[model samples]
Target: MIPIRDTAPCHSRPVVTWSLIVVCTVIFIVMQWLPYEVSYRLIHLYGMVPLRYSNPDWALAQGLPFDGYLSFLTNLFLHGNWLHLITNMWFLWIFADNVEDRMGRVRFLIFYILCGLFATYLQWYFDRTLEIPVVGASGALAGVLGAYFFLYPMARVILLPIPFIPFIFNVPAIAFLGIWVIIQLHNATTSVVFKGVSVDVAWWAHLGGFIAGILLYRYFIKPQAEE
Candidate 1:
């Protein structure tokens, strides 16, 4: 199920969220226009590789403070392809605004980065031996989805059944986000059994972000008085 939008009322404009989306899109567009070698180099330089980060020798040679320590932050902005970039950014657009409205600009930025950092570490911990580089903002976006689930559980979200199917169904935020989390859980579990080798994508990062988001929401957002 794909989320089109939510029913929660957004207060002030989500400057930080929109700006981040614009920045990511611009970076992706520039990379797309560049030659394959340049684009590939850019992703490698910015993306997070668990093995590269876990090795102190390589980190010393590359002048990095430590190996995987820094990749957690850099990896959030990296994407493998146009499709990856677009989908991640699209989700960011759909869900981030309301989250930012709830958290405010500065706090929201911190929340996003912190979630991304924690999520990346979780992914790395699951498979530190893998050399494949993990990239994309899905982990952070997953955090946004998690927050929305709690911040506005009663909000209506428009979901698309398929690419062409125009089924405009409104579901409660809890159910919507719950289904998303379940889907990710299903895929992550099945991947372990079906694929002998781990996939490059960081499914655990998505899970970690979700848990972090849920916890953060409970801590930061106070309960409103019932009408």
Candidate 2:
């Protein structure tokens, strides 16, 4: 089922969420304008490649920055295509406002970065020698979903069971997120996350980020008065 939006109210402006969407959109637009070869090279350089971290000699031989660790963060802002950018940004727009409101802007951003780093770490752990550039905001957004799963368990999510039959319904946040977890785990067990240029979903990264967000959100969340 596809999620439409959640029935939750935000008390403050989601500045961080809006900014993240704009930055990711702009980056994707610029990448679309660039030549395919250049964009491909950029993905390899900036996207999180597990092999790059696993084999220092291989990384050096390929002229990749063996010591540069920024890819874990940068990879979150990159996308494979318009569909990728849209789907991720849509989910972010839907759930992140409330999360940001709860965590405040600065703490929210930090939590986001940490989740992405942890997400990439999980992907790397599973296949340290895989030679593919894993890029997209799904892993990080999975963290946001994780937060939303706990932060708004009572909230109802509008879901479309079918693509285009004009059918939609409301479901508890816990149920929606629980189904999502199941799907990701099912996929992860069957296949690894990396595909060629298309950059298929990284199930391990999703689970990692989701787990991280659940485990780490308390540290970043503000009290009721603070929020």
Candidate 3:
């Protein structure tokens, strides 16, 4: 389901959200202009590779530079392709503004980074032996969606379900995010059983970020003014 927009309104401009989008877009453009080999090397150097942490000796033996765990944050800004970047930024555009509005800029930024870090580590925990470098903002964006799931549960979301005749329908935020979480769990389970952590999609990262957002948002949420 593609989320077009939501009925929830924001009280202030989402500066942090816009800044994140612009930064990701510019980095992706630079990545596209780079040579294929350079781009590949860049992703490996910055993207989160579980084996880098799980087996430092192996990573060093393979000539992978020690990034000193910074990849946990850097990986959130890297994208594998245009589609991957666009889809993640689009979700952030739709949902992150409201989250930022509720939490304020500083707290929202901290929450986002923490969720992304949690997501990366959780993926590493299960796929420590895998050599693939995970890149993209989906896990962090999933955190935004999870925050929306709690902060605006009753807000109506417009979803376009394709494959069948294209049509739009409004559903509660809780239901939409609930379905998203279920799909992630199913895919994560399938990846573990069949692909054994060698899959392209970081389903566990998404699940971890979503769970982190749900669990941590309350602490970061701003207190409401007394009526």
| Candidate 3 local lDDT, residue 194 | 83
State residue 224's C-alpha deviation in candidate 3, in Å: 3.0
Q: List candidate 1 stretches off by more than 4 Å.
A: 57-68, 192-200, 219-227
lDDT of 1 at 200: 54
Candidate 3 lDDT, 15-127, residue by residue in tens: 99999999999999999999999999889989998898888899998778688799999999999888899999999999999999999999999999999999988888878
Position 98, candidate 3: lDDT: 97
Which residue runs does candidate 3 get wrong by more than 4 Å?
A: 163-166, 195-198, 225-227
Query: Relative to the unseen true structure, what is the C-alpha lDDT of residue 89 in candidate 2, on a scale of 0 to 100?
Result: 98
Cα RMSD for candidate 1? 3.2
Best by lDDT: 3
lDDT-better candidate, 1 vs 2: 2
Give model 1's TM-score versus the native structure: 0.87
Task: For candidate 3, give the lDDT of residue 107.
Answer: 90
User: Which pairs clash in model 2?
Assistant: none
Candidate 1's residue-wise lDDT over 1-227, tens digit each?
77787778887898999888888888878988999988876676677777776785774665444533666788888788888888898888878889888777877888888889878888888767666678889888888888988878888888886778877788888887888899888777776678685565678889889888887765544235410
lDDT of 2 by residue, 94-206 (tens): 99999999999999999998898899899889768778888888888989989999999989999899998889999999998989888888777666544333336788899
